[model samples]
Target: MTMRRHRRLAATLTALVALTAAAGCSSKAKSGDDAGGQGADGVKTGRGVDAKAIQLGVLTDMTGVYATLGKSVTQAQQLYVKQLNAAGGVCGRTVELTIRDHGYDPQKALAGYTELEPKVLGFPQFIGSPFVAAVKQRVDGQDKGLVLPQAWSASLLGSPHIRVIGSTYDIETINAVDFLLKEKGLRKGDKLGHVYFEGDYGENALKGSRYAAEQAGLTVVEQKIKPTDNDMSAQVAALKQAGVKAVVVSAGPRQAASLVGVAAAVKLTVPVIGNNSAFAPQLLATQAGPALERMYYVATPSLPIGADTPVAKKLVADYRAAYPEDALDNGVVAGWSAAQVFGEALKKACADKDLTREGVGKALLTLNAHDAGFGMTHDFSDPQAPSSRQSAIIQPDKSVPGGARVAREPQVSDAAKAFTPGG
Candidate 1:
């Protein structure tokens, strides 16, 4: 062979290498296009989702009964979205959060939902039980978007469109009753007082109390009130006269403070356990702070802030950095946890390149024992089963970030397991 023959062979090899490189580049580009492509039905993927960003809605109370709790929830959602965006976002799109204050009003929540439904992919903070109840039908039937409701009522657990972050209020109350009987040495025949509102939130809690009472062979003295009622003196006096051993309250923070203060004034020295909605930092600053310190216990779905976990530590630090003037509130932690679950669902939906409302709903239904951080886990595999049944009992302590100290770790009690929403 001569030098000319060697030159021809080298040219052939160079041409083959160039052709192979072109094919590789084309395959990579096609994969990227497929990820960002339309669904099989040729419909747009998701509402409020585009090439640049995905928008989420928040309907919370900023100036109503649970103002502090609602505001903290909004802030926590913002912080989570910010962190997610900084970490390159989900499916290569930034997360944009839009918040609206319903002021704990059902009408206002309905209006806000109508306004935001067209613009957001989903809701991370659907605040009030009443509000969610008011709009549940429309949301489920018409809007058809995924919603992470702040209220964990048993009634809403059956809705396919709503995602609950923690244990239902009824389950929380059941665990609270169990905690009192086991930890506080309350006897089987002791009279337990139940002070609750009149709606589903209150009624659901009452159901749990009744179930636990039946199991423990205790008597429950009931005192029902409206959310508009500010004074609980008469209710407390009734419980005091009945010689109740312990009380379970399912009301707002103001009502909680009122009940505690009135109980202290009447010399009713008994443990006052409330549902998760009953505790807030503002209660610690009110005149009932001392009474809350003495008798207040809250049963919640997640670990208190400052728990020894990577997720908890990061949440505390991020919350403090984002809002320096505000203390760490469990409402915020709850909001962050909701966002985490929503993010997981979003990732799952995107995996199939179909980020529609139906896709998100399907993804949520497939979740099995998903750890939502802060020592909480959820199983959505069965639509009929409650989202979460684990709860922890905490007592008010002004020193902790969430203004409560964990008296018990999260556990799934038999009472919770036996809980049937409206049963």
Candidate 2:
């Protein structure tokens, strides 16, 4: 990479790392050849710092459509590592995080992977499904470096080496739809409306919603929107004409925000169900109307809006002390969760005598139905092999009587299992 690109990558990576490092640790933290420690189960250390520091490469979208989200997730990774070290480092070795920006471009994703091939582990955030699919073709059926994916949905398919920290797209969507239907007491033949951007992301959202709708015997009035088109007046008009009562939206913030505005303008107020990608407050806040009033979103971690829960409180406090003026977002929360899982895996990997790629894969496969009581839970046990389909559903208040409040606490289905380390 050029010097400028390398510097840019370093800047983004440092931002994430700095977000989670405990006070006094980053400044006095040991660097280079003196940070090594035990691998699994806190075994005895072999070499000193030089042998202990695990090189972890993080590939994220430093600049792209999901750049903000990617950056958040990367920050979470930073926090995880920082905490791990503060608590005596992972397996007695400090984790050295090296971040590379893929720009949300597929070719760049490939390039990023190639550049990071020499690292001990790869923790990629916001590679998205398309980039994952491309990488999967190359990594599957091959035993090489571990690819810890931060993207959900598409990343679940193919690739044995790339372990996921969240549930599959289909499962998340199906669960969300099911929750909405059951909670609202909706029966079969209920009319529903679907609005989404005409792309892979939107299509994936549609797939989950459709599956749930079919199970509940619901009918959908589907409308597609171009990413460039912001005004959803006509789409709302069509849905209103169809007499749709509930609407499921799967699009970006800009387009989804527009839909919310139009929905209220046309007086199609009922329940607005959205996929995980559409859960940003600013997105709905972009346009006026009651779009977010009863907006229901399906997400895993229920991060308190303003540092309420134990984890959120600690996150806010530590981050403030650490990063100070930096802001936290949903993506960062996801990243933190991902790192939690990876930390567990690393602990396990170091414990096992055979700490190869296959060994780590096996350990992760065994991590089914683990719950992080801080907020969310997951269950990845499958008939086949290791799966990353462990996530829960959370609903955030779009419009509280007084600004955005915690509408609903994070809730996981009975299917989610508690994490049992070395199980």
Candidate 3:
């Protein structure tokens, strides 16, 4: 990571924060970490089978635009399960994680769900919004069946039967923009432009950005493009023509990279901000060197990057040990986080001598204090209990001070925010 990359990442994070804050309307205070609750399904466990094996499912994009994201998240979750099982299993029962590749498609995700419906106590999905939209009803149909979804669509948050693990784009971008504007000491009524791919992803981001602009008394110039479109010169030129001061990009890595590079080519020097969807290395690779200058991104925990925090260190080591040939990336962190959440839930489910879906859901609701032994600390409790809704800003570096190695370390925000599924 380079300094330019660092700036870019920071800018992007600012936008994400704002979005999360706006969309995360559930005002439930952070209930401190505690255990002992009933599962949603009212099922009970009496150490049923001494050798009972619990199977969890991971559905994600394995070979698509978001391939790395899904793969890394699944891998980390697998490792977490492996470690938990190695440490005597959850509640003395071994956990078996079954991963299904959905290729980021809703149809495939539904198919995967159908395949795992018979045997799974719960399923955690990491597919993009499309897959989530497709199977939204199906997953919720589990009905207090211990469903943990990673997608942050506001619509799904209304389901009390399910658990959503992250912040919504609406709140993330709104909070982020507000913070960044205040930090930068920008004047009131300034224009913040958005160049994004046209879809739910982009529209969601736009909603947040627009809300922030209205609250802060700022102006917005918006442009839409295809996520696969590589030539954003036109969009960049349009933003410049609109005299936009800041630009928020709501697209995947490839599109983001293209837009940023085009901004540089067209000499649009305004600060560039990216939403969570843009979190990954592909953007960095696309806009190396000067192009990365003043580029900032909002990174969720799944992208390990150069995280040296305890959780990150352990994850890195485990990944290296598990897949020595494959270089460590973001997906590993996602998988690890997923496992960490489930592991805690499983433990809570067994806390009161009974393990069941109702117990797991109750445990998750009241569960807090997530210190993954890494730099990551996610505790979810209160009206909205999925605690790991934090987002950090990452600025890549070209070189290190005092001749140290250049690495990517996210500069997390001082302000901690909570995200409720629909609240």
106-217, model 1: which lDDT tens digit per residue? 5566667767777778898898876676556656655678898888887776678886777888889999999999898778999999999877789899999999999999
lDDT (CA) per prediction: 0.81, 0.57, 0.58
- Runs of candidate 1 exceeding 4 Å displacement: 1-44
lDDT tens digits by residue: candidate 3, 1-423: 334553553455444433433332232222111122333434355211123667677777878767867776777677777788889997667988788887764446656755554446666554665445444454444323455665555554554445555556655566456546755444577888887656456677677777767767888788877645667778888888888777777777666667777777777776666766665554444544357545554534333445555655666677878877665555555556657777787787677555655566677766666665534466556434434445554444434211111222323333224222233
Q: List where candidate 2 sits over 4 angstroms from the true fold.
A: 1-50, 124-126, 226-229, 294-296, 299-308, 353-355, 381-423
Q: Which should have the higher lDDT, number 2 or number 3? A: 3
Give me the runs in candidate 3 sitting further than 4 Å from their true place: 1-50, 141-143, 287-289, 299-305, 373-379, 382-390, 398-423
Q: Which residue window of length 10 is worst by lDDT in model 1?
A: 27-36
Q: What does candidate 2's lDDT look like per residue over 1-423, in tens digits? A: 234553554465444333323221343343221223444544433212134676766778768766666766787678778888889875556877888888875556656654554344545353565555454534553323456665555435445566555555555555555666657555678888888766456666667667667766888788876545667788888989998867777765555666767777677775666666665555534555345655555444334335356776666566556666555556656677667776676677667733444445566666676654345555444423224333344444444311234434554333222311111
lDDT of 3: 0.58
Best by lDDT: 1
Worst 10 residues of 2 by lDDT: 414-423
The TM-score of predicted model 3 comes to: 0.77
Best by TM-score: 1
